[model samples]
Target: MALNIVIMAAGKGTRMKSTAPKVLHKLAGRSLLAHVLGTAEQLQAQRTVVIVGHGAELVEASAPGPGRQFVRQEPQLGTGHAVQHLNGDVPLIRAATARALIEACGGERLALLTIALPDPTGYGRILRQGQRVLGIVEHKDATPEQHALREVYTGMMAAPTAWLKRAVARLKNDNAQREYYLTDIVAMAAADGVPVVASQATDETEVLGVNSPAQLAELERRVQRAQADTLMEAGVRLADPARFDVRGELICGSDVEIDVGCVFEGRVSVGSNVRIGAYCVIANASIADGAVIHPFTHIDGEKLGVQIGAGALIGPFARLRPGAQLGDEVHIGNFVEVKNSTLAKGAKANHLAYLGDATVGERVNYGAGSITANYDGANKHRTVIGNDVHVGSNCVLVAPITLGDGATIGGGSTLAKDAPAAACEDEEALSTTSAARHRSSHARALSCGLRSR
Candidate 1:
């Protein structure tokens, strides 16, 4: 028996007040329907079909991967009608129907995700004849007695496939609302002597449907908390779970430390012993072990994912854009920006600066307030600096240039072409007490020696 899953996501989302389809609105970097489909995937469904109406093309593209299919519903009809539309796609889907079947047939710890509210208004009531579901009655047509029934239909169930097919066919639209009701299947199953089991969730957030931006925001928070719990279980220390947000993916290794107010979007992986400070936004990036990202740093890997090597230290306010790769022990400090650049081991750009489309070699000391002008506001170019080279403060190294090994640059020089000077161009001045001066000169290699002497 092949298992098939159908996701009802064809709603126009009139309540959402947006042009986007209801389920197309994202939750945890994926559509709400995608979340449901992901859960279905967990169940290992042989076939997963998404019902698309509004933004049909976009929805179809979102989940057309292996084992996933799409069905379109024009002029969106009722829930029962939506199920009927999938007749050709899923055969004998009774297992997708009611809770009773799951309790008797599925796993032992099987449970339902539902919640009751003080105002159980505008919802379909879950009707049970004894321990079995008789069917469901809608709010618009429910009698005074039926209206008193508080248990509402969650539009979610898992049952024997044979029963689900039969129940769906019996839905009726001969009521006040004149809308086909899937809730009728519940009563139909119960009357036919089918037993269904159900469990209730304590929080209403679990069952709340998103029909608007406000609702979407609330659901996003809940989903993020769920993700946070998973990380904490894996031994990751999160300072404040509520303040953390992950829009894409976050894969954390053991003993990772994340401070409060960090936002991780796109795809990000953090290695062990990594420390992400407060208010950091990292996207589409990978940070190796022993790396420390200071507070308020923003890294957007975008199309080209950024990679920070082991022992690297990024700024409290640095921006690492697409294609930025920092090697071991690379230090990028406050207010610096790197794009399409690779900083070799021990390279340090410790103040306000920019490095673009550049290749910096080992032990290269990039100066403060400096930049590699790799763009002509039209075409991009590259700048190459060899090992042990030293760049001076406030110097602009224009692209298509190369600074050979031991080459020294002068302070405040806007170099459109490459040249070399004595490696210790400023060794005399470096002997001064100011470490900043040593770090900002071509004699950067003498920094440690100057300190010792």
Candidate 2:
């Protein structure tokens, strides 16, 4: 059967006190309208009709595209009146339109999405006669017994398209508020002897309408909890799910461990056996298998995302910006920042360095405090380091330059032009610093070599 979704979203939401439409307000990195459309699509809704008003264009754009269509509700009417604006805009849902919709959707089953809230104030209360629904009583007109009933109707429904069409036709606005209430359709449906079925989901957050900043915040927490729970169920260890915030989509592999104070912003993927340390903020990035992102790493991939290769070690205060691509076993240590740069396999930028707009070669040892001066006042440039290069501390390799293979850059050397890394090799270090080369590859101690004056 072809399922169709009708989203009623024409309210001004005066309590929100903002210019933007209430449905446009976001909960989990996506607009509330987007969330509704997504859920409806998941239910295999063949067509979605969004009733738009109050920045109608913005609301229409926020809803899902392709199969979705929009209808305008002008003059800012009440719920029933807003729906009445269906007019010629919607192919379905007009007076006597339900039968046409049923023919289009291959009618087999119908269900209304609703919730049962604890406090049923300001909503229409459901009136049930035995096992059948009688009608809906608005909160203002509900009797004391009806007021005590917690079961309320969220203004979302599904039925045989024909019956729905008739219900809308019979709706009235003769009330104290003088606003037409869509809930009146329930009485019509019950009176017509049409069988109406309702589907209820617990956790009122899904059906909560955002009319204020406070409600928006509450919904945000609910949405985040759902995402966090999904991640935890996927074997990703989170220190505190409540403390974590995923603003964008996060895809994680097996055994991924994320510590407290972590925020994954945009589209991010974590490979198997990955460990994201505390206070790390990652966005629009992909981390390969077995990678360890240490504490306080802030990675924002933006339009052009950052990619960290397998078995890489990053952070303790690392910032990987857009266009950063790290090869296997790359080490980006404390106070290191890489922007629009590529670090080759086994390369190490172990501490206090900036490699912006640069290309680094395999097994290159990027020294502490070493930087690629890729930006001048006028324009940005690139620096290239060839294979097996050793860059010394406090060395600044200016932009639009390249170092040859097995090259050595001297400590305190500022190379404005292309050169070899042979300036500070271990062979030269014997005569220069008179210090033995240690077992480790990276510089552990500064060899301030002097001449026997």
Taking all chains together, each candidate's TM-score versus the true structure is 0.81, 0.82
Query: Which stretches in model 1 have alpha-carbon errors above 4 Å?
Result: 84-122, 143-148, 158-171, 190-206, 420-453
Position 384, candidate 2: lDDT: 91
Q: Per-residue alpha-carbon lDDT of model 2 for 307-400, expressed as tens digits? A: 9999999999999999999999999999999999998999999899999999999998888887888878999999999888888787777788
Local error of candidate 2 at 141, Å?
Answer: 3.5
Error of 2 at 346 (Å): 2.2
> What TM-score does prediction 2 earn?
0.82
lDDT of 2: 0.74
Candidate-wise lDDT, in order: 0.73, 0.74
> What would you estimate as the lDDT of candidate 1?
0.73
Worst 10 residues of 1 by lDDT: 84-93
